[model samples]
Target: MNLETFLLKDKIQEIENGFKIKNGWLLICESTYDEIESKGIYCALIKNKYLEKYSSSHSWPINYGYEGKSNVYGDNSYQTYDNEEVEPFLFRKSFNIKDGIKKYIDVGEEFILFYRLFEEVADKQNRVYYFVNDYGELDEVIVVEPNKVKIKLKYLKEYITMRDMHFFISFEYMILRKTIDKDWNLEFIDKDFSNENYFYNHLIRNDMGTYQSWILGNYFIKPNVSKRSYLDFDNFHCEEFIIGIDENGEIILKNPKYESKGNFTFTYFKKEVLNKYYNNPIEYEIDSFSVSNKYFRLKIDNNLENIIPVLLTDLLILPENEQLHWKQYNIPITEDLKLSSTYYKTMILGNWYESPESIDLYFKHLYNDFNKKWYQKFGWNLYKPLAKEDEFNFKALHLITENNIKSFCEQTLTIVKLTIDRINEKEIVKGIELEPNTKGISKFQKFLESKNMDIPDLFEFLRHLQSLRSGLIAHTFSNSNKECKKALEYFNFNERNLIDIQKEIFKKSIRTFSTLETHLL
Candidate 1:
């Protein structure tokens, strides 16, 4: 028997014999892809065919081309100035499908196209294939000729015999026509399907009630099949029943919607079939990618880094077909980033930013996010915390200020000294001038010249600090109250300056370290 005939008259009749909801298309949830790990589409059936637009709407805060800012919508005088209200479907129109698949799945064309299944339209293509809601439970796909379908289904069941098989029979597709009032809203007037069946009275006759559209969505299992097969429809048979070669491939079924699903069969009526049949997927595969090992890797957003000389930097998420390996890296793969295999190998084999401009922008954004926090963290390490009272705290002049001004100045001086050393192995220990009678200002000047860092103001501040410590601070035991007050006053203003310069020193040092690791692109 034709699947549609068996489904409409016998199968549906058997299922709907005494089922609770008597009015509409009914597909029940029999199983899932993975009960815990898998998240598939399981939605309500019984649609309201006439009412247009879903009650819910989505918002994407990007205004114009800029993210996190608003643009054109405010000028409209209407007090209802909500961005979504002004442009309910703006996000979908603003971006392409690929981008829509990313950043904002619930907005744009993906939203309009994918989400219509959620609303009770019961018709994704405005046609009812199977008159049902598909619960996205089909993980594996098997493609074969129409006569070979029984063997194909059996072959499919073999893959499930050992592993758990999740069968999902969705009943939400049961069509329900509601009684409505002046506003055309559902009045909930209960008309029993127990008496008049939409399947016999309307759908089978090709006279769709009220809506004037075919129900039960459909798709072509063999999208790439030749046109010759379509032209030779007169010789078609029950093999056509399993899969049809149309008798008059193009004469009847005026609905372009009907033309899409071949002549008579309604199995592939919905877009659900296309995702499976278009490529003709076989065994269910986990649609994700992960790094190969336990090594923690950076997942940066730089696509340009792919061409650089850097090694072991960032793993850009790639698509499945684009992947080379998926051996369980520490990175958790999500639908947002399927994580490509080539990108995975590239991720494990890191690269650095070669473009100076890109490096600057990337580092600046990194600094703003967390590198500045690290600078603050290092500043804490450079100073000694002094508690004046139970709840009062103050940072001392330097790492070990109580020892002497010489110790204090030396601590800060090491930052620049160590930085230069880290920047180049040849420069290590070369900056400290150990000449005859080299002391005080002469020594400081020689040191600054040898290091030749971009941070001059920082060294100047360090010099002034050294002077204060050598003169007034070194004699802490013999200092008068007036001198102590003077020292405190100097520290109050200069301490902040010291911290700011340290931040710059840290920024430069970080750049230098990254430079050591990278070859400029």
Candidate 2:
């Protein structure tokens, strides 16, 4: 599509300022900003492909505008960031349906499409303005003069921006069917034009950006009322001036400009809709699977998938009495633990134990329910309402891998160390000030000692993790490194199975948290 296709009157005239197309309906005029003479202030007419940077194999002009100039401004502004070439064939004809009135626009790909109701109020002195209210009914606002109407229209634009667009927009296009069947009202059927687009092509096919067709729903268009008003002065010397001309060769001056110092562009033309109904449904599910052991195999799906995991978890984490209840099913304790793999992917290897998310969820429940008043005294302080940074770190604490071992360790160690430090700092929780610079595992050890607590196994586990980081990550990797070897031996894991050690350590950390919650509370 070329300029001639959409041009109702195809005449490109040379005006005093610059090039005038469609008589004077649209002008590429000379615009001067400040004292600097430049001419790049108008609605750009170019291809849609040029909208995105590095989208096409195009090379843009280097010196079209000054450094740091935005794409929305200056000559060939519509040109690609790197202009391959502004091929004549690249530009296409498009239509913008503003206020029920269809008009032409220039784009490279598909047409820009959307409906805006009440874009411009009629300027006639006797014209009645009906603004869409919260109830989808038009609210009458009478203005005797055109200028007053313009002012109210400007205020209305601001109101739309400040308030919800839904209440102001009409949704008739999406909900209403053209046939006026048993479902839709006759009034809506007459106005709905979306059905035509649903069948037709080469019309207003896409919106300016995303290129999506009009969203489905019921809506009505508000018409454009503000006509093009030009600067009457011939020697139109202003600090800055940007103008938009319609296909009818008239200048629109309703754009916002600072009283003395600022720029002027066209009033934001809006195509609005009113929607009455909306619904979003979840269409997600996981497939069924089987849990097999030496004795039996249980098929799982839906509720089974959801319920079995918790039961298995209880068998591992709950008291002996709880463990006995599941044994009635004739499932071995070891087999049930392995079946946990069906639910949580991050569960410790085949043991199907717990994930970071589950850990956080566990602590959150404990904090919210049990330690509401004394979270700082209990270990729930870290998770009662995790800080934004801590929440981010915790969310990132997923399954360990060779690629993410370093990050996983760093994030895990940070969370644990922070929790320990927070507990130590609380005066309600008894602790000692061993040294000002005490940090990490040593610091945690001192805090435990201050509380007269002895958990040598937990301390050793933390030290092993710290050593892994220090020897393998924080410093440098060496096969002969004793600290690294000790850390690996502590988990009965070797260099090849480092990920396994990380996973084991992660599970231990969760258990350590459980211990903290149990004792601290």
Candidate 3:
């Protein structure tokens, strides 16, 4: 049979309706809802195929390739092919329903077909589809094909027994079932009653014996005219009675409050029905009540409004009491100066100064010690021979003194020459150019003249002293160690003091350079 021919919209609708009414039979299984919805039109087509076959009482189990099995059709053993031919098809076959109900009654393959149909239907509808057992109980079935027929049936029965089944079947399910079983009774129960109590008292009370309560709960009460008795049935209710007609021709109670005319009739049902109707049936405003345990009654009134305010007040007062308690126990105290003497003790020991801060003071003390040592080592009265007749303890001192003076003069001349070169490069001085005539002394003097700068008198004197110290140390003198020691002391004092002075002078020079650059620019 061509499965495509059965893919009609009406047939799909029929299958959908069948699933709604059939307890536990979901045309759309819960698992496949997302997948089917995502592929909407494609799902609809596949669903149509199943619904059409289902409506015609044919099997529409999705054929997944099956396992090999042999079957005897006419007393001859026919070996079933152990390939795709024997494998259950993933798509349903037209003869699946009849074959499933008949030959495959206990076969593991039937369960696979059952679940496939269930899944296809459930997927298209986007709701959980279920299967029903012979006991009229609804059951949730697994999406996968069952390996054992008994297991599948057991699951179906378990799910049906566990779930709270809905009595009213969907119109689509009824339509499909009607196609197969036209003589099937289609009873429509009235759901327009305000409360189950009224229906129990007035309408379904008489029909209780005819209609069994498949599930237990509050039932509608109605008059069973055929039996001439009041019936209370779980599923059926009556329509509103007209003023002129007997119970047989009366309008079914669709909406009685809207239909009833007289004030007395309307008021009676309104008070008992409309006023009592809970918009949200799940929630209710319960009143305080007393419970009796044996001989005594315990009254419990735990309304939120009455108890919350007192709780809030108690919470607010707790922090204030804690603060007061802390204040009472924690007293403030101050220590006496005598008890904390660290600062005073450090000052008294004279070890209170940081190294960097006392460096200048330390250097001053060192300078004083060096000067004293120098005076003691070499007689301070000894001086450069003012006259040629003065006898010198060291002859080398005179030569060293002359060399030192000459070196200082040469250095000063070099500095002057560099300055002159700079001035010439900048074209700052534009008068007569100074030129040296002599080879050595005249050239040196000329270099100084070009820069128009002179060496300081103090620097010249220091240079002469350095030369004298070098000579004395180099000469074979009786007290050479003494002279050398004195020379070292003098050199150290001058070197240290000069370096410090030069650092200050360099800083000032940098500031002068900045000013000069600004002005020149």
Candidate 4:
């Protein structure tokens, strides 16, 4: 919502003279005041009845203007204020009594007018302009073309004060800084406001500022139009909000909004997807055993359902339920997000990759496959491999350490081998020891070497890694074999070698897998 202000040619001239204004609130219209005076139309204006320091006053001593729709006659001036400034004329000329008059005085161009003290003034037709309104107290607007609504500064100032915010800005690479003086005056420390690079270099480069975090969620977001034009975050020469903190002390991220044709960066779904899609599922499970909890856990508090309203408010979006904070509709926080980055990625991107425009099927398919397999086969066993089974059921339980490692080992190794096999499909080798002629490197390693990739130990490592299953068998046998004594005497058996081999194999498998994934997978 914007405040309204009144103005006329005579009033503007008076303000331009020695008369002062408060908070610099006044509109300057292109049309002559005489035309409006003839109309006897009405309008309101904000005046500089009292010009106090830092209040930014403007004088509007209009001989003819409207305080309302009705006309007023005077050699005297009038004043008023509105966020939408600039427009002209007096009583009869102020506005039309009928629809015709309305069409005549269509405010063609207006400016939230202001003037600099002690500056030279040119003739009216060719005079320079500076938006000296309440919003631009610190700015020196040398050329405020009709195209720009400079009053936005007032709205911005209001926002800052009302919200009690802290900020840094760099609009489209233009350095813009705002600071408060000891007298509570908001001013700029612009070393050279004329030079864009000076601000960029000083604030962005030297001052360590960034706009990557700016997004729609943090601000009083609205459709980019009129008063909302400031929402066009990516508009060139536009101010970029580098950082901000809300009333709740949450970190406000900067997300520069770029222009798009008939589309928006953020979208809302009418309902949650209670129905799961079966076409290509993203199978993701929480990695409770993960070394880094951040990768798996949701950073938000566990009271997710309860906090959605707060999030929506912070995001400046309409909340689903304002009274949700009160105990009315009970929505449980069912799934704990402390599992993996998979959920966040998929959930965030799902909207963009949805139907209608199909550009990234290949990548999307891979993503779905990875997540599906992760949830379906990997994360289930991550924290408690073998389903909490003790050293008893070797045949049934997954006797491995981590959930995904075993499958990862198998999958990565297969990819590595398949890649190598693709390059050497027709070759046959006769070997007695792992390699026919080389130093214990397998065909896979040789293939990578030929391709000028780093060689990895494959056969040798797999030879040891393959012992895990056997080690499990031995452990089972050693634990409860009915003929253990007889079997030991006959085979001269000791489970130590198999046990040792299994441990080495596990280590080697991890190392080999990493190398293969790096070189080939």
Judging by lDDT against the true structure, name the best candidate. Answer: 2
Global lDDT of each candidate: 0.27, 0.34, 0.26, 0.26
Model 3 spans with C-alpha error above 4 angstroms: 1-9, 15-23, 26-68, 71-86, 89-104, 109-521
TM-score of each: 0.18, 0.28, 0.13, 0.18
lDDT score for candidate 3 against the true structure: 0.26
Worst 10 residues of 3 by lDDT: 266-275
Off by over 4 Å in 1: 1-352, 355-417, 420-444, 447-458, 461-502, 508-521
Least accurate 10 contiguous residues by lDDT in model 2: 271-280
Off by over 4 Å in 2: 1-390, 401-437, 478-482, 495-499
Model 4 lDDT per residue over 453-514, tens place: 76434653443323322332223435443344443333233543432332343344345435
Q: For candidate 3, write residues 222-276 as lDDT tens digits.
A: 2222321111122222222212212222212222334423222210010111111
Model 4 segments more than 4 A misplaced? 1-339, 348-441, 446-460, 470-514, 517-521
Report the Cα lDDT for residue 64, model 3. Answer: 23
Ranking of predictions according to lDDT = 2, 1, 4, 3
Of 1 and 2, the candidate ahead on TM-score is 2
Clashes of 1: 44
Ranking by TM-score: 2, 4, 1, 3
lDDT of 2 by residue, 139-234 (tens): 332232311111133322222233222111111011111222243221211122232111111222322321211222211111234322221223
State the lDDT at 359 in candidate 3: 22
